[model samples]
Target: MQVRLEQVTKTFAGSKNTQATAVKELDVTIASGKLVGLLGPSGCGKSTTLFMIAGIHDVSEGHIYFGDHDVTALPSDKRGVGIVFQNYALYPHLTVWDNIAFPLLNAKEMKKRLKQRFAELSPPMANFKAYIQRLVEEAAKLVELTAYLDRKPAELSGGQQQRVAIARAIVKNPSILLLDEPLSNLDARLRVQTRDEIKRIQKQTGITTVFVTHDQDEALSICDEVIILKDGVLQQQGPPQEVYDHPANQFVAEFLGSPQINLVGGSIKANKLYLGNEEWFALPESLSDQPVNIGVRYENIRPDRENRKQAFEATVTSIARTGGTSTVQVRLADGQPMRLHRDSDDVLQEGDRVRLYARPRTVYIFNAEGEKILQC
Candidate 1:
């Protein structure tokens, strides 16, 4: 099902009628049968956006549409969306079958939809009891929980419990699936395993899925397109690598990378990019001479064993070892700390001075107001 939001806004009243906007006038269309991710940091309106789609939070203004139906004022029960929360929200004492079947047993919306479906079936079939059993069985199979159907929640591993939660959410065959940080509870290895499983299940189900997460890697890896948010405003939305390479703003460039993008004070003087009096890169003619921030990814900076003259130089401040790669933090001449990506094979210690240069066509120049000037 296709879901679209038009000029959607949500506000909460503070202590004295002062309101805080949790979600601004946001407009996004989730295509039919696609997995889209809502990614951002804490309190960036990602969860608020998901909640509004689920009809748990009413919009302060504007409308929400499920395909052609305007469901702006619909209650949560009537939205036909299944939400799997971070906690997994399973009943400790109930078996997996019971947990997966609970939604089908209690949902009025499901009953209403099933009634409509029943009337449309050929020969006016009356196998209602058998249909529910098929739903439970199918949901379990989707999450690879066919063998653990009789086990309790506590008796299963963390990954198993999460699978049960997913099975429970999808059992009713919701029109749209809302997953809010669904894999945050599992360990690193289990998270990747379950993430792949989710992608597979989503492909088979073909439901419009909205996955909310703060992890950039998770969103980039599992989503077809990622919508980035910051401070109640939609920053950018596109395929992960598209947004990563060509960030719309400084916040997005810094927020999406692993070691974070480096921001250094630079100036465009006489059509040349100047970093602390060194002419390292050239600026485009479209961008006027002005002060700017040079955004460089960690991998774009390389340490030179032979200290080349006329190159941007810095003194090594610290080194952080993470597996095979090392993060070398260096202090520029202006005292600003810059980080470089280096492998373990390089022998560079703290307090060692090294000459470095920015990779060509791999840096971004943003104006003083944090707007993009150009990227080269």
Candidate 2:
């Protein structure tokens, strides 16, 4: 199913009669059978938006559609959306099979499905138990939990319990799947493993999936497209690499990268861009003089051990190495701090003087209002 939110706004009543808008006129579309991520920092209203789509929270304004069907007023149970939460809300006393079969046993839904099944089959399809059992088995197999089907939730590992939750959510064959930070509770390695499994399952099922997460790495790794939000407003939405490469604004550029993008004060004067007092690049003549923020990815910066009287110079403050990569923290000549990516094998020490330069084409320039003004 293709999910669309058109001008969807969600508001909550605050103390003293004030209203807090969780989402503001959000308009976005999730293509059918694609895994899309709703990514942002905490309190950015990603979860609120997910809940509104699931119909757990009503929209304060606008409409939500499943394909062409307007479902703005539908309840959670009526939306045909399966949500797996961060906590993996599995029933403690239930075995994996029972948990996976829980949604299949819903009185109203089961009755409707059984009625349709009987209508479709000759002799009324009497073996209903086998049908539910087959569904449970298939769901368990999809999540790789077949061996643990008879075990209770507490008897399983955290990853196993999470898989059980996922199996439960999908057993009903929902039109859309919603995942709310489903890997947040796992250890680092397990998080990676489970997220990959999630992507695989999503592909096999071909269900329209919306995943809400604060982790940039997870979103970039698993999603077909990512919608970035900040302060209840849509910042940018695109394929992760595209958004990372061509950020729509300062917030999108700063929020999407690891170690964050290096930001420094700059200005344009006489069609020339200056970083600190060093002239960097020439802008179009039609552009007026104005202050700007220059953003450079750590990878774009080259740190040279020999200063060579370059236009920009810095002193290495510290170096942090993880695995084979290194991050060099440096203080510029004008006392501004910056980070650069360097080879772990390179010899460097604290307080070492280094010259800095970024690829001109990779730098991003943003104006006073945080709008991206130029990319060079």
Candidate 3:
């Protein structure tokens, strides 16, 4: 199902008779059978947005359409969306098979809804047991949990338990799947492996999915399109790399990149962009002279001794090495700190003074109000 939100707003009544908007007018469309990520920091309304789509939270204004059907007033259970909570929410006493089939057994309301949705394919009430058993087995196989069908939640690993939770969500053949921070409980190594599994399952099932996560790497790695939010407002929505490469504003540019993008304080004077009181780059003669934030990505920064005349000087302060890559942190001549990712084999002492240069065409400029002035 294609999920679309049109000017969907969510508000909460706060203390002292005031109101706080958890999600502002959000207009977004998730294509059929696509996995999309709602990404942002804590208290950014990402989870609230997911809840609104799940029909758990009623919108303050506007409507939600599930492939042209207005499901704005539908109850969560009636919306045909399966929600997997952050903690996985598996029952400790139940075996893997039972846990997956639990939703089916207790789905009194779902039976009525599903019968109406698929009237021609609906089986008789007496055949419901066989139907549910088939669904449980199919879901278990889909998530590769058939081998551990009889194992309890405690017997399985964190990743395995997560897969069982996913199986339970899909057993009902939901119109859309809603996962809220489902990978946050796993270990680092397992998190990576499980995210890949989630992506694989999504592609195999071809079920439209909305995944909520605060981790940028998780979103960028698995999602087709990532929607970034800030303070209840939509910042940007596009393919992961597109949003990363070309951010809409300073917040997105800084939030999307690892180690964050370096924002050097700059001033425009007499058609010259000056950094740390030194003329850094040339600006247009017609542009007004004002303050600007120069954004330089880590990958764009490189050690350049030959370009001393135009390079910025900085002293190596620290280095973090992992695998074949190293992250180097340095303090500029003006005492501003900067960080960059480079080859792990770079032979440089912590106190060594080096000249740094950024790819001129990749540099980004933002105005004092945090709007993008130039992005190349």
Candidate 4:
């Protein structure tokens, strides 16, 4: 199913009847059978957008569509969206099998809906219970939980319990799968493992999935495309690498990366750009001279002992080594802080004077309004 949100807005009533807008005129199109991530920081309205799509939260304005069908007014159950929440929301008293089959058994007009959806593959009404059992078994097997079919939620590990929740959500074969920070509860290693499993299962099932998350790594690692939101407004939406390489604005550039992009003060004068009073690069003469914020990724800035004509002087303040990668912290002549990533084997001591050179094509310049004015 392809999900589309047209000028959608969500607002909440606070004390004194004040209105707080959660989402503002959000227009997005989620491609069919693709895993799309709604990614942003906390309170950026990512979860709000997901809930609106699931019909759990009502839209204050505009419309939502499942393919060509307008489902703006539909309830969550009526929308045919299966959701797996952050906590898994599994019943501790129920076995895995019962948990997976719960949706099929509890939904209204289950027999009729099942017959309509799985008519060609299903058996007669006399074997309905057997049919439901087969569905539960199939769901469990798909999530690699067939062996734990009789086990309760409390008895399973975090990863296993999450798989059970996923299995339950998919048992009904919903047209759209919605996951709300599904891996936030797991440890780092488990988060990676479970995310890979999610991508694999999504590929096999080809269900249109909307994943809401605040973690950039999870969003970039698994999602086909990511929609970045800030302050209840859409910022940027694109493939992870594309967005990282060519961000639409300063916020989008800074928000997507892991170690985060390094920002420094810069100015353009007479078609020349300067970093901390040191002439660094030349801009197009057609551009006007003005103050600008220069952004460079940690990997884009290289530290060198040998002085270069284009490089700026900086002193090494500290170094943090993580496995094979070393993050070198430096301060410029004017007391501006900057950082760069280098090989852990590189030898550099504190108080060492080093020249910092930024790759031309990787440099990003943003205006005072936080909009990208130049990206080389």
lDDT of 3: 0.88
Candidates sorted by TM-score, best first? 4, 2, 1, 3
Q: Cα deviation in Å at residue 265, candidate 4? A: 0.9
1-376 per-residue lDDT for model 4 (tens digits): 9999999999999899899999999999999999999999999999999999999999999999999999999988888888999999998899988899988988886557986656566345456677798889888888999999998998999999999999999998889999999999999999999999999999999999999999999999999999999988999898888888899999998888868988889888888888979899886445678888988899888865466677889999999988868899999998999989876556788999888787677888888677665754
lDDT of 3 by residue, 269-372 (tens): 88777777777767544557888888889988889857755577889999888877888999987888889877655677799998888756778778877766
lDDT of 4: 0.89
lDDT measured at residue 120 in model 3 versus the true structure, 0 to 100:
55
Worst 10 residues of 4 by lDDT: 117-126
Candidate 1: C-alpha RMSD to true structure equals 2.1
Provide the TM-score for each candidate, comma-separated: 0.94, 0.95, 0.93, 0.96
lDDT by residue for model 2 over 291-357, one digit each (tens)?
8888999998886556444347789999898987899999877788899888755677998986777
> Best candidate, TM-score-wise?
4
lDDT to native, each model: 0.88, 0.88, 0.88, 0.89
The residue pairs found clashing in candidate 2 are 360-376, 361-376
Model 3 lDDT-worst window of ten: 117-126
Tell me which residue pairs clash in candidate 1.
Answer: 361-376
